[model samples]
Target: MLAAGGLGTPAQAAPTVTPAAVASHQSPSAPQDLAPTPPMGFNNWNSTHCRAEFNESMVKGVADVFVERGLKDAGYEYVNLDDCWALPQRDENGKLVPDPKRFPNGIKAVADYVHSKGLKFGIYTSAGTKTCSDIGFPGALGHEYSDARQFADWGVDYLKYDNCNNQGVDAKKRYTTMRDALKATGRPMVYSICEWGENKPWTWAGGLGHLWRTTGDISDNWNSMSSIMKANLELAPYAHPGGWNDPDMLEVGNGGMTDTEYRTHFSMWSVMAAPLLIGVDLRTAPESAFDILTNREVIAVDQDPLGKQGEVVSSEGGRWVVSKEMADGSRAVALFNEGSRAQRIETTAKAVGLPQARGYTMRDLWKHSDTNTAGTIAATVPAHGTLLVRVHADRNWAQYPPALDVRAQDTVTQAGHIAPVTSEVTDLGGNAARSVSAVLTGPEGWRITPKSATSVRALQPGGTLATDWHVEVPTGTAAGDHVVQLTAKQRTRSGTWLTSTVPVTVRVGVPLPPGESALSDAEPLGSANGWGPIERDRSVGEAGSGDGRPITIGGDRFAKGLGVHAASSVEYYLGGACTTVTAQVGVDDETVDKGSVTFEIWADGTRAAATGTLTQTDPARAVSADVSGADVVRLVVTDAGDGIDYDHADWADLRVTCG
Candidate 1:
């Protein structure tokens, strides 16, 4: 199912889509054009993920937003579908079909509605015999020609063919079959080959389709986005006018990455001339998403007629420049600073493969203005930020708004635990920002407190502000990936505002399973001065366990357990999220002067479970405690009687249960 948590609020009741509402789902002239520039539009995968959130009504709403929000005017025409739309089996005539319940009116019914809004329609399919859905035989494997004909007849203008359940078929042969099928239909539907970049499709996908994927699926995270871009940047030569190298779908408006990260993502995609198909629900996207998605200047650079991809011209000191050559002799340069703080990036026109030395108009692509620069252009790029500027004889660049840098350090976190998030923001751009404040947004009922001051009076260029925030995760919070955005808002004197966002992904682990382990199985963290990573049956004072110090703790099923001497403790992550822990602790019968020892379990800062002092001849007592929300678990043994005489204790049959 699609993870739509980050897109927007929950869906609302919407108008149903009907075939008659749209006029036969056909374009007036067979859609003469085919992604001359990378196709731009909204895809449901990132936002809806082929989950129940996507329906006929929702898709209709997407088209409605496309027109209502000026996305159509911005050239984002194709509204694509990714997966999970097909029924389990084909019709009696061997034709694929959409899920009747969701698309009650049928595929053409929705396609017609999309066409009525002056937008193209796209559908998804897998090359493997069984689409990704193993339960339902929905893959378009054997029915390539028939399926293509059916789609063309239904006015489907674009096809997003995926690779899944291929059953060992050749990628070229399978995708080639669909390409030929689309050609046979005589309909000019844009074919998007989605082979997941496994077969090095860029090498052979020159004319296979309008675009071919050069990487695997892209997650809405900084690492996922940047990792793919780093790979696609190396394949710029393979991208041309018709055949494009697809990095993946756009994650803008998905609420996963920060606005800055999304800008970087969009900028990189444009630089590569990859497909600009957005994977967010446009209906509920915020204005920030709108600004990033429909930036005419950025879109123009992407749609440049030359169809040349930008290459990594220079990379050093965590700063890099990727510039693309346009047909009009202008160059689109993306100056990126991947450093932790602000970096002053500078380069000469000749450095970026420009023919002339000077006399080029350097326009700030993001700001949509000409920067005043001639021979050498320099700008301070923010951390994890980009300065997209088109340099040519058009004009010069202008002073930039103060760019802030926000940072945080949490990737995986635990529910019911409080973790500290730290950020060091700096003013990387020209002017001073008046009243800079750190704004935080996250899940419902989350209590966030900044340990240090959250706001600063004035942040001048080169000045940095630090904020340490603590987030308390509530119990019962679902386990999965959750994003928290830390934004630094800069209110300037000129009424100009700039906001920098840092996205924190917290992956909560699942609860611990019920299992018993021998005391020897616990991996020890050597904390005792030296010689202490106590192994199973090993004594704490020596190289081996059980140092022959008269320690013998046994149970009905087994005999060995953690043999701990006085003043020793062991730690564990509990292997998983444990809800309860139980164990037996006692002194071995062999200890003649077995003094006394106590067993205790500590979680975080509180002692959760404990066992009474045990002496020789005392039956192994079962000690149990509720650790429903515990993460780090520790077991400690302490001497209760005379100085380490014979205080050997064993914790046996330790069992942890999640329930």
Candidate 2:
């Protein structure tokens, strides 16, 4: 139901009712009468310009026509005068005044005129330095408060705050600033924030304003209307009462769109819970335009107070079907054929979350009629046309049997003494390969190698493999689990070799020993060295300084290229004598593995204290490890023996804390 205009405060009491009170009072559960549903109104900007050159005769002429055409009686109450109705400048006290030439009798007289006709008056302004029409005083930045108060004084019921030149500042803050200012005026003016959805205003603007523009400026054309509707459908979840998602103003009654397209536009907007601000020349609209605009069934969904916007469930070609869950446990569906040829669209209740149902009532909003149906329903929609239906099931409905569901399979993992490896190759071939030789087109260090020949190939639980390759896990390679891949070349008849590979998971036993340590205490100087100084290739032997002993690890020793090289340790002698220990190390790119590293420790030089290793089968990755123990500890960079480059390794601050 729509609201009638009145000046009573929100908290004011109704006139005393005698023993015969036939009218229903406001519900106690629903406080603060919401602005009203189905905002039926006509806006001037789209059809006629209200410039300074136009006079009072023009304004009265439009108002008289609105009443004569039964628009006001049909519930289109607000005769909103958009931009350019106001002068280009403010008065001495910086207050906006209506254009004297356009509004000769003053804004107060115009307001009285509109009120006498039992209609509300709406005005437009900018949230920026200039209005879109390039007229009227700017009300953005610091002038929101002053302009809001002035608008309230002029008896304005609604404010359309446009985003013109108001850039740089955060949009939320700017819109909220004006909202708070408007609230302070002791007037309940509906705040419309026009930001064009930059940063998705619907996500946050609901709490700040009554409505927000969800798309770019809409033109009076079918293409513009359809594009705006499509964008709004994707953002339907944000519409609700006290706030709405605006797809610009109404263009149905305008001449640019055909009758078929206009029907689709109205149905789509209703399902989207978009504002129905009529932007046509209402006084001179044809009968068909009125019929399209006054479709009762479509308006029911738009005015459903539940305020939920419908969403598109599927689309084939240009024919699309959208559904919205109504507050009454019913579903509102729209079948739209946007293509050049008519199409038949069908939807089952089960597909729309409604299972088997009996005695279903389908209401055709445009035809203002209801049809009974059972189970699935189909309709033939003309090109650029729509068929909107609201479906309700009887209480004795049953659910349908479920359909078969398919699940994805998992890949197997390999086992061995080889180091655990994980690789992530970007911008490589579209597929993954197992053989080092297959991916070794550029260099040898780019592939993964197993510790031995006995390792069996096992696929990962997930992920598609790029190639097929051989697997070999050698005995006594290592004492722990390892992952390896082999690439094999399949020669074509033309002698062109293509590579295929598979990953092999191997589990072994002998874990390698931790590396040796040489340097001493490595500490930051000057208040914990918040930003330490450790120049490349530099070394220091001090317990408290940020610099530590610099040890260089060589890569030319290991068969795969290089293995773990340097380590640092602190000793706790008998009789409670504790000396601080620290170390720093550098790598010549060849000494470190780009993939993984491990850290370990040995107490009193023999018994193992802690142990761990890291491996990267892919050369373009890095991993870190932390090791700590009582007497001694070691850090190892495994897969270091693998033919990979570790050119980016710098270890610092290896220390021991004693109890």
Candidate 3:
């Protein structure tokens, strides 16, 4: 997935790759000692992007930042250079050389300078004849042995071998040649395979290199980071102590994402044991990014001797919980909120492979505090935010009983209207609970699902039973908050019954003031077109293909509102009392850092509020339209650019002003 701009020359179309060919070049066993844990270092891609800007002085400057910025003390070591760092051709003796202009003093001097700082030096080359950004560089296709000898002679300690003009050779064969060549160099350089996961490297990369790319190059945006993170989770089982997964470089200081998103990115990467190759301009990174990149406590979890990759133990309602077993028997966990609004994520110690006793002594990694781990640990995570913690065993009897998670809207419409309710019951105990059931109790006039006992045959530990309920606020219900309770009961294999109760407060909202309600709370007209169910307070999931999800939440512009993808046209009724419409519109927050979505509000077929064109990174803005004499107002989000590659448009606080 290298962008056209990333390639110095047009990529030749190659036929489909075969598994046999990929396997032919793979080694029986890659040196397990090369990367005992994920490599921590900085690379020169996100900052320089393979341009001629990479020179000996630049590498030296990065090395200096490594020490001055406290990175060296935080376990960061190697300082590597990516594409565009070599000469157009080799020397008379067929030795690849650095560009004389950029590295007039040569790479040996740069390696010496890096080593002088008590750090390691890394260089980049390609499997093809020409590098991805060969601008003035030749790749290491046929000259692997010679180039390896030269790199070893230059005192290089790490090598990032990429895929570029590879002359149609099999991926395994091309990469194998370099790996064997490096082994022959007699230098202990860390070998990183940069095949970009084209041939399912996770399947056969065990002994090919210390680490291999799990996906194409990552960008400094939310969608790109999120997709890559999810993909990495699937390949978790294939990772080991020596052969770790490399999800490209770090983008913590990259400006495309907000502080919260960056933390989510870094936290996920750390939990999964992905190599943390810093990809930002370390010299001028902001304090927040600097703190995030240099957090030693977080780094300890990654460098733990157990070397186990993290897994997603809990996933529901746009939230995911990941857990990694540490060497000391403690567990490191991270909760992520992928939804647009503030979401609540909960999990029990027993559910994440932790033995349940009374509870656990948990230390919040981000909050940097000791907190409660009693019954269930729950955190209200902001959109794209993460809550990470390290949990130590307290009562280690290995008991995880049935844990229940229930959430409903804080407020519901007047009587006779139904609101959404989601309930999840899990058996966190070590054994399955037979005849599991849930019951609800509430005030008069409110109707709940099943209205009777809902029976589940059995609830196994780590298994969850999900139920969607609707609470109808009877026609004459009071406009105030009322407490409703849901109780879960289960019997263990020994026939002992245990029950847990969760109480929720649901408020009945008063009728809308004369003019109207927000589009999220308003019903879509029959004349409108809707994609899936009109979302409220949550962003839509990406479509996976085609134009991708129509909307990016655009950074949670408002606390409450509808979420939907674009090319969407929907109208809300306001009656004759509405005077004006005001709403904030932006590309949703989940965009892929490209393309644009158009937002428009039509008043009787006349354009009123609109955002001409907004790229993925654009923030949400207020758009006001005059609906003073209108009966129905329309909201239309369209693909504005070449295509809606990443346009997740959200119109928040879409309310009509009445006088």
Candidate 4:
């Protein structure tokens, strides 16, 4: 039976797409010309999949938002539906039919409306007998040619062919059949193979589709995002112009993660050269989400003419450096922090494959500003965040202002306490900078006072300047990551003013009392779990707070500790007052002898202690780490080379000693 539904929003209603309207549009270009660069657009699966609200009006409104919100101008051309847009069964003529309730005027009418907005329209179907949705919409398995012809008649410009209920068919054969069918239509629709990387589509899909999913579906969380990143990072060579390694869709503007994490998500996608498909409802997205989604500099990297995906240059202890060569001879570098605490991540321009020069221009993609670096590229990147920069050999050092390599260290402060913040600037240019000055500014209601001379008469080439400020956080200010802006300015010979700005993340936390105490009793200064909230005195449960059973590891029960999923981190600001941290760590008994994990404790970006692989069959291992004089303590768990399934880990009886 066909289910019916109305459009979700009542915004500017579009008329039914008529046959004449379809006739008015011309056929698209050849398949090779489909996506010269990775496609940038919207897909509804991640946000509103199979929901009653995902109707014709909702899609039409998306097309409107694309145009009204400057998304089309920003290079997002397709408005794509994911699943459940059609009837459970095809029509008697063997044509896939859009649900009458969902698309009252039929799919062609909606495609026409989308085309009217100067945007391409895309529909979804599976290679198997049924779609992935619960309703089991009819798929284009044996009826590929008929369905493709139906799609062409309706003026569809893109097809998202999915993988579900494959019925033992060979992945390559199934996808290739659809490709042949679509090609036979001569409508020039872009094909997106949604095989979820199970068959290593990147190895073969390039010749058949514009893009292919390199990973499974992505969730709106740090773990899901980073894990997918890890999977796709090594496949850079498989991506090229007209074909991409799709890492699912963009989860930006979704409320699951913080703004900083969302920025990292978008930045990494751009660096990977993946499709930039909006996966959230644009009508109600927050301005902050829009800020991340509409970052032109980041988008430019994803759409770079070179079409080269970034590859990991180095990854150790949760710090990752990825680099991609741009068509303009520049390289996009991403300093990623997969850890829980903010730490200084450093890399050299040469390390990222840039040719040696007098100085390199390091353009901060997020800051939209240029800075000079002799060779060292470094910044204190926040946890689960990314510092994306474009570095290239300086062509005209004199034409630009002296490169100011400015950065600040991560600071941990308490409410109403004055903390010393330092900013270091080096002149990486061949020319001197006159009237050099620096300033530090804090958030509103916080006071920042200069502690050292903020100005120097002149900064010669290769000279370095260190400035200091005392930042006082207001009492009662919420604890967490706070921004402290460091700005450096200088005057060029042409009387032009140049300035470089970097943000220092200040964490405000309560000091631990003198004596041993259970870590679960105190709120984490920062945390990112693979599943849900960091559990207190319980096993890591399914995706909610206080949902776990008692904390138990390998038949050993504990009363005090933190339970977390694998690939998790719980950080605390120790303020150099903690002496040691001890814990009994192992895969939780809740997994019933089915999981494996490794636990590590980090102090100020250095691993203090680590446990060998502990599976559900092994007893909890006692581990202790010296945290004396360390500003922060981080507890981390990793899925031991296996998948994260049943990887519920426990830091049983975890305790920290302070003062």
RMSD values for the candidates in order, in angstroms, are: 17.2, 23.1, 12.8, 8.3
TM accuracy, model 3: 0.63
**Model 3 error, position 277 (Å):** 0.6
- Candidate-wise lDDT, in order: 0.70, 0.53, 0.72, 0.83
- TM-score of candidate 4 relative to the true fold: 0.87
The residue-by-residue lDDT of candidate 3 on 1-659, one tens digit each, is 25432201111112234455534434436666768899999998887886666777788898999999899999999999887777787889988878788899989999999999999999998888888863636888889999999999999999999887877899988888888999898898888989888787766676678898887778787756776787677666667788887778889987989999998988888899899999987777788998899888888888887888898897775689999999999888898987544567888787777775665666668657553345466655666788888876765423433333333334334556776666666654445667877776678767877533367888665567666677776887765446677677776545777565555555454433664656566545422212334466555544322232333344444666556565566665444456788877776665456546788888755787787987667677788888766545778776673433444567677677765
Q: Give per-model TM-scores.
A: 0.59, 0.54, 0.63, 0.87
* Top of the candidates by lDDT: 4
Winner by TM-score between candidate 4 and candidate 3: 4
Candidate 1 residue 549 Cα shift, in angstroms, is 30
- Once fitted onto the true fold, the runs of candidate 2 whose alpha carbons sit more than 4 angstroms away are 1-38, 49-70, 134-137, 395-659
Residue range 86-108, candidate 1, lDDT tens digits:
78878899888788877999989
Model 1 spans with C-alpha error above 4 angstroms: 1-33, 134-137, 394-659
Candidate 3 differs from the real structure by a C-alpha RMSD in angstroms, to one decimal, of 12.8
User: lDDT, candidate 1, residue 158?
Assistant: 93
Lowest lDDT sum, 10 consecutive residues, model 4, at 4-13
